[model samples]
Target: MTVASAVPRLLIVAVSARRQDRRARLSQEIAGMIERLGGAFLKAGQLLATRVDLVGAELAAALGRLHDDVKPMSTRQALLTVTTAFETVPAGIEAAVWTPPVASGSIACVYRACHDGTDVALKVRRPDVARRFAADIAIVAFLTRAAAKLPMLRRVPLVEIADQVGMSLAAQLDFSREVEHLRRLRTDLADLPDIVVPAVLDELSSGGVIAMEYVHGLDRAAADKLPAETKEAGLSRLVGAVYHMLFVDGFIHVDLHQGNVYFRADGTVVILDAGFMFRLSDMARTRFTQFFAGMIRGDGEFCADILLSTVRHVEKGADVSAFRRDVTDLVARSTGAVAKDFELAAFSVELFDLQRRNRLFAESEFVFPLLCLLSLEGAVRRLHPLMDFQLEAAPHVMHGLLLTDAAVT
Candidate 1:
C-alpha cells in the first residue's frame, strides 16, 4: 500500500490503542478513588462492573473489586445518616448501642440491630450520596456522549448506557424503591421455595433507610462447602427466576453479583441490594423472551431474527444477510452439543459481539440480561462444571416460550 493510503489505517490503529490505554488508566484510578471516597463514586464503580460493553473489560474488572472492598463511612456518619433518613431517632436505635456496620456499599451501609422486639438489618443511605451521584453522573453523561461519536465507540450505545446506569445509581438512594423491589420479587418468586428474598420491615423504613428481615448465610463460595445436589438445585432455581424477570415481567435485578446475593445454609438462594434494577420495554420483553426460547430450541435462524428485531439501529450498507448466516452457523454448531459444554455465557457474549461487528446498537435493557446470564453461568459452573445447562434451562426456557405465545395469542 502507498504511504498516503497506509496513513489512515495507521491512524486508526493508533487511536484504538490510545483509547485502550486510556481505559486502563481510568479503571485503575476509579478503583482507588472508590476505595477512598466510600459513597456515590463507589456505587458507580460497582455499577460499572456490569457494563462491559461501554466500560470495556479492563475497567469493569477493576470496578468489580468495589463490590466487596468498599469502605464504610465513619461510625458517626453512619448513625447520622440513619437518623437523617428517619428524620428522628429510628425505632430500636438506642443512643447507647448502635452496632457497627455489618456491610457497606457506595450508597448505603448495613447494620444489624433489633427493632420492635425482632432482630433486623438496617440499610442506611450515605449522607450526601444523592448530591454526589447527581454531580458525577452529569460528568459521565457528557463524557459518554462525546465518546459515542468515535468510530470504534459508535457501535455501542455509550450515551444510553451511561444514562441507564446513572438512573439505576440514582434509584439506589431511594430505600423505598428497594423495599418495593424486595416485596415484588418475593411475591413473584413465592412458588420457588428454594429461593429467598428477605422480608421488608416497613415500620422502620424511610426514603433513605430501610429495615428488613435479617438473613444469616454463607457467602457465594458457600457452594464449595455444600452438597452437589444442593448447589445444582439452588443454581437451577436461580436461573429460572431470572428468566421470569427478564422475559415475562421485564423487571430485572441488575446488580446481582456475588456480594449482593448468596446461598443460605439450607441452599435457599438469598438475593440482596435492589437499588439498581431494569424495567424493559414491551417490545424488548417479547423479543428477548422469543430469542432466549429460540436458543434453547437450538434454532439459530429464529434467534437471529429476534436479535435483529431487538436492535434499535443498524448502520446502512452493513451486510445483514451475512450477519444472519453467521448467527445461523453459530446456532447450528451448538445443536446436539453436550449440555455441560454449551457455555451459554460465552455463547451470549459472542452473539453480542456479532451484533457489534455488524454495527447493530441495541437498547440499554439488553446489557442486564447478558450480565444476568453470565452471573447464572458462573454460579452453575462453579458448583457443577459437568452439569448440562441446556437440560437444566429447558424447563424454565419452555415456560417463557409458553408465556410469550400466550401473550401473542
Candidate 2:
C-alpha cells in the first residue's frame, strides 16, 4: 500500500531490531510479526531456525519451533478443500471416514483414517499456506537485500542464501512434489530391509492431500523408557541410512531430526518428510571426498583447502586462511593420531561452531554439508557411541579422492 500505511510495519520491525540482546524476546516478536503478516514470514521463521551455523545455537533453537503448517480449518473447510480438488468430497464417504488429526505442524497435519479394513495416515496440506508462504518469501528477500548493505552480512552473502531458503520452503509446501521425493528415496533404499518408507497411495494423492501407509510404530517418546541398547539399535539404523545417503548415494535426507525418523518395534528405521532432500554435484562431492580423506590421514592443510573452497561458492570476501586455521585446530582437537579414537558428534559440533565463526554458515542451496554433518553426527551419537563415524566414513572419502582425477576447481 501507501508509504503512510507502511509506517506501522517498519516501526514494528524497528522495535524488533532494537531488542538484539534479548534473543528469545526478539525471536518471539519477529515470529509474531511474521505470523500476522501471514505468508513469507512463517517460511522465513522456519528458515532462520535451520541456520544454526549463522544464527548461533540459542537463536536457532528458538526459531526452530516456527511450524510451516497453518492451523487446520473446520470440517466444512476440509470438505471444501477436498471438493475443490476433486468435484466432490468422495461419493462413498459414509463407508470410509477420517478421524480428527492426532498431530499438526507448519506444512501439514496427520490424521488416522481407514478404508477397506486397512489403516492409513492422511496428510492434508493447509489451505492458503502456499499463498501466505509466498508473501513471506517476498518480504524475506527484501530483508535479505537490505541486510546485505551491512559490513558483517557482506561476509555471509545473505541475499543469495535467502533465495535458497525461499526455494526450500516452496518445495516443502507442494505435497505433490513431496510424494515424488518419498518415492525416489523409497526406490533408493528398497534393498535395505532395516529402513522403511510409507507406501504412497497415488490415487488418493493430490496437490493438497496425501494418503500413505500409516506407520504403526513407537515414536521416540514411547520408547523413552526402553533399554539403552534398544535406543542404540534405533539410532544405529538411522546412522546407517544417513551414511548411505551422504557417502554412498550422495543423496541426503536433508532433515533427520527426531520426529522425521521413527523407530519400529522391531527396530527398523522409517524416514518421513523428504521435502528437503539434496544431491551433491560431481565436483562438490569430489571436494568433500578430499576433505574427508584429509581428515582420515590427519592432514590439516588438505582439509583446510577443501573447507575454504566449499565456502567460496556461497560466501564472498571471507578470510580463507583464518577459516582454514580454525578448521585445522578443530580437527586436531577432535581426533587423535588414529582415526579410531575420534567422536563424530563432538567433532561435528566443533565444525558447526567453526562455520558460525568463519561466517561460512549454512546456505539454503549449498546445504549438503550441514545436513550431512548434523544428521550423521546426531545419528552416530544416538546409535553406536563406540562406532567412530569419521573412521567409517573415511574409507569412502579416501576412495572418492583416489578415483576422481579432477582438480579442486
Candidate 3:
C-alpha cells in the first residue's frame, strides 16, 4: 500500500515536469509561428505578452519579441498595397521624388511623399491584412471557448475578452481610425504645448492610406543622448500628458513602446502609431482613477475597494473579506518601495499577478492599459529614472478626478 501511494506521488511529479516542458516548447513554437502568421497573430502576440499572469512567464518571454522584431512585409507588396489603396499614384508621388518606405510592419508600411506640395508620410496597409486579422481572431475565439470549460479559467470572461481583442484589431486595420485617434489626442493635449502629435493632411488622406505631415527629428536613441536636465524635463511633460489622456480624456494609445515615440532638441515629445487606442468605459475610468489616486496616496483600503469594483466575474464562494485583506496588504507592503525605488512597470506586473491569484478577472481592455503604462514606464526609465512620475502626474490626475467627481464609487 505504501509503494502504490508513492507511485502516484512520483507520477504526479513526472506529469508536472512534462507539462512545464510542454509549455516551454509551445511558447517557443508560438514565437516562431507569429512571424509566419504575420497579420493579427503579431498583434495578438503583443497582447499575450502582457498577460503573464494568465499565459505564464515562458510564453510571455517568447511573445515579447513581437514588439519590434516582426518581419516587415516586402517593399514590392507594400507599393502594390499603396497603389490599391489610392487606385493610382497621385501626381506628386508619381514625380521624380518617391522615396522607399521609411518603415514597414505586418499591417502597414510608411513612405515619404511630397504630395499636394506638402511633405507627408503616406501610411499604406498590407495587402489582405484584414483577412489575415479575421483568421487569427477566429483562432483566439476557438481557444477561449475551449479554455473556458476549465474551473480555474472559467473565472475569466474568455468570450468577452476574445471579442475585445477582435474589436481592437479591427479598429487598427482601419487606417481612418488612426487619423481620428491622432486628431482626438492632439485636441486632448492642446493645453500642453511641448507635445507634438502629427498634423493630419486631410485632403491627401483616405481609407487605407493616411497622409500626415512628416516631421523630422531625433528618435529614442538620440533622445537618450540628450543632456540629463533636458531629458528629465521632457519626460515630465510626456508623463503628465499621458496621465491627462488616460484620466481626463479616457482615450489613450495602447502602444507607446520606445520605438513608436521620439523626443526633439527643444524638449518637445513626439509620438507615433496611434492605430491601437483604448477608450475607457465610464466605470473603468472611474475605477482606474480611484485606484491611481489610492496608489499615490498609499491608501490600501481605498485601493482594495476600487480593485474589487474594477474586476469582473469574481468567483462565487470566494472569501470577499479575505480578498480585500490581501489587496490591502499588497498596497501597504509596496508603500516603502514606492518611496524608495518605485517602478510602476514592475508594480503593475505584480498587481496583475495579485489580481489573478485572488480570482479577480480584469478584462483585456482594462489589463491592456496597465501594460501600456508599464511600457511607458520603461520608456521613461530609459530617459530619466530619477524623475518622480507621481509628482509630475498628480496635477493632471487630480484635475481629471475633480471633473468626474459625480462618478466616484
Candidate 4:
C-alpha cells in the first residue's frame, strides 16, 4: 500500500518536473510564439535586427540570428490547405507530385518533386500564414499609432515603423510578386551564369502557391570541403552579385546571410528568399551614398551630420549625445578593423550585447546598410582573410558617396 502511494507521488513529481522544465523554457517558447504570432513580430524582429538605433544591440543581435523556422503540419493538413486555398488538390494539376515538405519555414515549406519530367520545388505558404499576418499587422498598426502618441515612443515613431512593416509584410505574402522579383533579378544577371534563380512556372503559381525549378547545391557547411580555388570563386560570385545588387542595381536583398545563400557543385551561388528585398528611394540612396562616402573618407563629423539628418530623432527627453557616442564607437570599431590585418570581419554577439547594455538603437533602419557592409566583409573574409578593406570597398564607397554630394550640389 505504501509503495502504491509512493508510485502515485513519484508520478506527480515527474509531472511537476515536466511542468517546471516547460516553465524554464518559457523564454524560448515566447520567442517561438512571437514568430508564430506572425506578421508583426517577424517583421518587427527583422526590422529590429537591422535597426541598431532602436531595439538596442543585444536584442538586435538576437533578432538577427532568429530564423524563419516553423513546425510542419501533417500531409493531411497540407492537403486541407491546398483544398481551402485553390478549391482543388494541387498535386493533381502538376505533372509530378510532391510529398509533404522535407523542410518548413515561418511563411512557407519546400517540397522536392518532379513535374513534366523536370525536377521542381513546390513552395506552399501555410494556410493561416496570410490570415495570421493580416491580423497581426492590424494589431501592430494600432499599437504603433498608440506608441507614437506616447511621450517615450514619439521618437521611436511606431506609426511610421508600422507603415514600413505593413508594406513589407504585404509584399512578402504575394508569391506572384516574388516570382516577378526573381525574374527581374535573373534577367539583370543573365550575363553571369555563376548564379541561378529558380524559374517560376506561372501556370502552377497562384497567390500563395509557387512552383519553380529546383537548383541543388551545398549549404555553407558542406561547401567547406570544396577545393580552395572553387571556394574563392564561389565567394567572389556571391560578393560580386551582392555588390551589383546593392551598389549598381540599387535593389537590396534584405536577408543575405549564409542560409539564404547556397553553393552549387559547379561553384555557382544560389540565392533564396525573395520576401524582403529593399529598393532605395532616390533621396534615401543619396543620403546613404553620402554616409558611405563619409565613412570611406574617415570624415566623422560629416557622417554625424548625415546620420542626424537621416534618422528621426526624438523631440525631447532622449539621450542624443549618448546615441552619437555609440554610433562613433561602432564606426570606429567596425571601420578601424577594416584597416587591420589581424582584425576579424565577423560581428560577434558580444559586441551586440555590449551595445544593448549601453542602450543603443533598437529598430531595423540600419539593417540594409549593415547588410551591405557585412556582405562585403563576409566575402573578403571568405576569400582573402588577410585582405585590407581599404584596398577593396573604400574606392567604391567613396565613389558612391560622391553621388550624394553631386545631388546636393
Q: Pick the candidate with the highest TM-score.
A: 1
Clashing pairs in 1: none
Q: Write the candidate numbers in order of decreasing TM-score.
A: 1, 3, 2, 4
Q: Candidate 4, TM-score vs. the true structure?
A: 0.67
> Global lDDT for candidate 3?
0.71
Clashes of 2: 10
Each candidate's root-mean-square deviation in Å? 7.8, 6.8, 8.1, 8.3
Clashes of each: 0, 10, 0, 15
What TM-score should be assigned to candidate 2? 0.72
Please write out the lDDT profile of model 2 over residues 74-168, one tens digit for every residue: 56655545556664454333122244665555666666767567776777766767776787678778978998888755656567767875787
Candidate 4 displacement at residue 285 in angstroms: 1.6
What's the lDDT for residue 343 in model 1? Answer: 63
Better of 1 and 2 by lDDT: 1
The sequence of per-residue lDDT tens digits that candidate 1 reaches over residues 1-409 is: 2224545544554466566476675566657656665545665466566455446678767877677646667768767766676657666753412566777677777778876677787877778788877887887788789998988777877787778778877877777778888888788778876877888987778766777898886464576687878877777777778877876677888777666878666868888877777777877777777776776688888988888877777788677887898788888877555535666656766776777777775556777676666655555555666766655556666676677777789
Q: Clashes in candidate 3: how many?
A: 0
Q: Which run of 10 residues does model 1 get worst, by summed lDDT?
A: 1-10
Q: State each model's CA lDDT, in order.
A: 0.71, 0.63, 0.71, 0.58
